[model samples]
Target: MASVADNLTMALRKQIGAKLNVLLLRFFDQNKSGEILSRVTNDLDKITETLQTGLLKLLVAIGTIVGSLAVMFYYDVLLTIIFLVFMAICIIITRMLAGKNLKYAAFRQETLGTLTGIVEEYYTGRNVIKAYNHEKESMEQVCANTELNRKATQKADFLTNSVNPLIRLITRLSQAVIAVIAGTSMLKGTMSVGVVQAFFQYVNQTAEPLTQASYMINTIQSALASAERTFELLDSEEEIADTKTPVVLNRAKGTISFEHVSFGYDSSKLLMKDISFTVKPGQKIAVVGSTGAGKTTLINLLMRFYEVNSGKILVDGISSVDMTRQGLRQNFGMVLQDTWLFGGTIAENIAYGKPDATREEIVAAAKAAKVDYFIRTMPQGYDTMLDNEGGNLSVGQRQLLTIARVFLCNPPILILDEATSSVDTRTEKEINKAMQELMNGRTSFVIAHRLSTIRDADIILFMENGNIIEQGNHQELLIGNCETGLQA
Candidate 1:
């Protein structure tokens, strides 16, 4: 039974992990990571414990009760009937307590999930909290969550622990009444002392298991609450299924167009309405906007990270919806402001985009991105092991490694979303020089707040309130030649 329970738990964890992987980005946006993690970890542990011990104990208690009752009946049918009446009362009381136990157990789990979310948030933002001198506020918030969890847990434990003693009290009273009746029969010479003693032995046997069974049942009920939460996550909606026969784009020519594209994080309130734009092959398009002007949203739509509500995005003149997501994304290389590095050798991090890259190829890509010298200066050079997120390297160094990763892929299209924002002016100029050579024959989309960096872009798109307000080359925008109301 223990082995079966363990294997089942492992299978369930794997299934939940797989489901989370395919779920849409919207699901993640709506749910807290820590809450989801609690369901997968703590709740599953509760289920495993119940299955391994509580379930087995309950089964044994049931067998013992049955066997004891059989012997009691053979010894004296009248006494057995009386005993069963008392057992029925015990069952009714236990059923009532079990119902309350389940309610408290569910409450306990919910509070635990909330507490987990609070802790996770505070831990990740500890640096910001300290910088802003908000440590006291953070501590208070965590304490409040912890208090709620404590109350919920206390209530649930009280119910579970109280069941066994309550059932035992009822059994003891029933035994007292039975003892009186047997003693009277013995005094009247109608029942033998040996029979009376033997009957009491069976009575004890039945009562003991009844007590154990009641406690185990309550414990199992708590686990059932946890199981319900796990099932909720499994039942969450998944991403829309891929087409039966998706269009395959092996090597796109990097022509992208957004025709009447409309979208919103919430479908009812469209953020980008009837937005249309087109880009030719090998053109540099710069998207410039204030905060929350939907620059990133446009890129997200192009990459199909979030689906459009009422229009089409085309890659190489083919509707992107018809193409496999992998096929569409593989043709575009992205370097974001936030660099992500794992615990691995520097060579492995550089070769992330092209896992099978040769050592010579990795070095070449690093050199193109202007990070090869830094790599060589490290104690182990390309083989140096990086901690999580490359903690040993400065932010600029990490950004350069991510840039090198994109260089290795050499995709048909490139996306640089504040890619140079973290680096110094000298490093930024170096990256820009390398980027110019890299964008020679490939389409590129640059999302930037630093307007000077995109001065030479083939076209500039000025967006506001999710609409393209003005667009032209830098010189045209500056000279006001396109006749748009706004100028650069």
Candidate 2:
């Protein structure tokens, strides 16, 4: 039974993980990592515990209770009736306690999830917390959450543990009353001494099973609360399904058009309304705007990470919706402001997008990104193993490594989302030259705050409040600056 339970739990955990992997990005935005983690680990463990022991014990207790009742009824009907009256009272009380137990158990699980989210948030931002000297504040927040969890756990445990003793008390009282009535019958010569003894033995059997059943039922109720949480996660919204027959784009010419595009994270509140833009193949498009001006959102729409609320995004004259997300995304390469690296060798990290890349191809790409010299300085060079998130490397190095990944991919369309923001000025200039060569024929979208980096772009787009307010070549925008007071 234990082995079977383990296998079942393993399958459940795997299903939960697979569901999370396919859930829409909005789900992640709304939930905390630690809360999700708690559901996957702690809640699943509760279910497993119930399956391994509580379920088995409850089944046995039920069987014993039924069998014992049959023998008692056969011995004496009057005494059986007396015993059942007290058992009914016990059942009513246990039922009441079980309901309360489930409620408190759910509350306890919720508080635990909150506490986990708090701890995970603080831990991930520990460096910022310390830099700002907010250690005391962080600790206080954790303690407050912990106290909530403690109180909830106390209430749940009180309800769960109290049920056993309460039911036992009621059963013992029933046993005492039955014993008194049986004694009177024995004295009146209506019952044999041996029959009275046997009835008392049966009473003991039934009473013990009743106590055990009450306790196990409460435990099972608590586990059910956990199962509820796990199922909730498994039932979250997932990404839109792929097309039945998707347009396969092995290679794209990189002509993109946004035809009256309108979108918002929330469908009811449109952020970008009636926005339209077009990019010819091999053209350089620079997107510039203040923070929250929908620059990144535009990129997200183009990549189909979040679908547009209303509009058609066309790539190479075909509606992107007609293409599989993977097929559509395959033609574009993106390097974001934030860099991500895993625990692996430097070469492995660079080859992540194309796992079967040769070492020579990896080295050539690194050199083009101006990170080859730095990689060689490491003790094991490209073979050096990086810790989680590449903690051993400087921020600039990490950014360069990501850039190298994009360089190797060499997609027809490139998105550089403040990709060079982390490097020094000299390195930025060098990367700009390399990027210029990279963009010579491929369509590129450059999102940058620095005006100097995009002065030579083929066309510049200035966005505000999710709309493109101005767009022209660098010189045209400058020439119109006096009229519109536009500043790039």
Candidate 3:
């Protein structure tokens, strides 16, 4: 019975953990990954540990205490009453400790989460810290978090450990009292030797279970603390659900338009206000701006990574909000400044956008991205396995792989966000040639840090302070700027 109950508890814990894992991606997208990892791993482990042993011990203790008490009464009613009074006192003492155990357990779990966050951050950014010669500062931060975790764990463990010894002391005292009562009754000729022996045995049995029961109280409090943290994450608000009867974007010609758009990460301050733009099918549009000029914010809105405060972003002629998110995103291909390559074969990375792509299809895309020659130089060619962080590949090589992924996808609309910025001048020229070929007949949006790259664009939107201050072909914007030495 204990084993079955324990298995059920474990299964329940796993199911809840799995649900929390999925919800974390959608609900806590802005939250740190380390905090989520701590809740799923450390917090869930505490609940499992208690359920596996503490629960079974608790149940056995209850049964033993009742059975022992009944046998004692059958042997001698007066002796049983004497033990009961002492047992009641022990119960009161254990009750007084409940709140403190809870407080410490919760504090310990919280500190563990903070410690995990520090360790994760330090490890992920170790290279950056060393590059900036801030290794000493990073180590100091790690030590600070470690010290806090140590103190909290010590307090929680001390409280839990203190319970067992106190319970044992009370049990010994109760047994001593019971022994005297049994001795007196046996000498008075009212009790036989056998009954006295049995009575003594029952007293010990009762005390042992009561001691275990007291310790179980502490186990339960600790488990509840961890469970509460897990539940808090599970209950966090999820992303906005798709509208009822959402429009499915079956196919689109890629004409894009943004009408009177307004948005801000914080509601009190507007970042992009009343923004409007249009790009006809097959047109090449370039958006150039200084840092913090809301250039990326515009792209995020187009991809629906964020919703606009007040505006309509249309793909084809349909409002983005009307379409299901998945259906809407299917029409676009994106290559961002940060190239993401997972631990897999080079071929797999290129086929990420089309998982079932044929080998020939993958090879063709690589060639178009101007990376085939490089891949051939590798000993394993397409089969070469990438390191977890792509440590084996150069920055330009990683970007080329990402571009190949988009080529195989072949969506009607394309977004290149500083796509060639990470490469050297030579590689940038080759990548730009490949990109131009890919963007030939697609409605494309280019967010460029290099003005030279977008000089030939059909339209250039030069923005400042979240508004387009100038919009025209490159020559038109440059006509007066050359004379004044100031941007139009």
Task: Note the Cα lDDT for every prediction shown.
Answer: 0.90, 0.91, 0.84
Largest TM-score belongs to which candidate?
2
RMSD of each: 2.4, 1.8, 3.3
Which residue ranges in model 3 land beyond 4 Å of their true spot?
A: 1-30, 70-85, 180-199, 469-472, 475-488
Q: Give me the runs in candidate 2 sitting further than 4 Å from their true place.
A: 481-488
Compose the digit string of candidate 3's lDDT tens values, residues 1-488.
45764575577577766666445233555666788788878987788778777888998999999999999999989989988888888788777776788888899899888888778888888889999999999889889988988998898888788888898898898888878877887899888999989889889888888989988988788888988898887677544666788887776788999999998776678888888888889989898888777777888889888778898999988999998888888888999988899999999999998999999999999999989999999989999999876779988889989999999999999999888888888878878888889999998899876666568688787777887777777888788456422243
Deviation from truth (RMSD, Å), model 2: 1.8
Each candidate structure's TM-score, on Cα atoms with residue i matched to residue i, is 0.93, 0.95, 0.88
Q: How accurate is candidate 3 locally (lDDT)?
A: 0.84
- What is candidate 1's lDDT per residue for 284-375, written digit by digit as tens? 99998787888888889888999999889999999988988898999999998889999999999999989999999999999999999999
Error of 3 at 148 (Å): 2.4
Better of 2 and 3 by lDDT: 2
**Stretches of model 1 off by over 4 angstroms after superposition:** 74-76, 184-198, 475-488
- Name every residue pair that clashes in candidate 2: none
| Lowest lDDT block of 10, candidate 2 | 479-488
Model 3 TM-score?
A: 0.88
Error of 3 at 330 (Å): 1.9
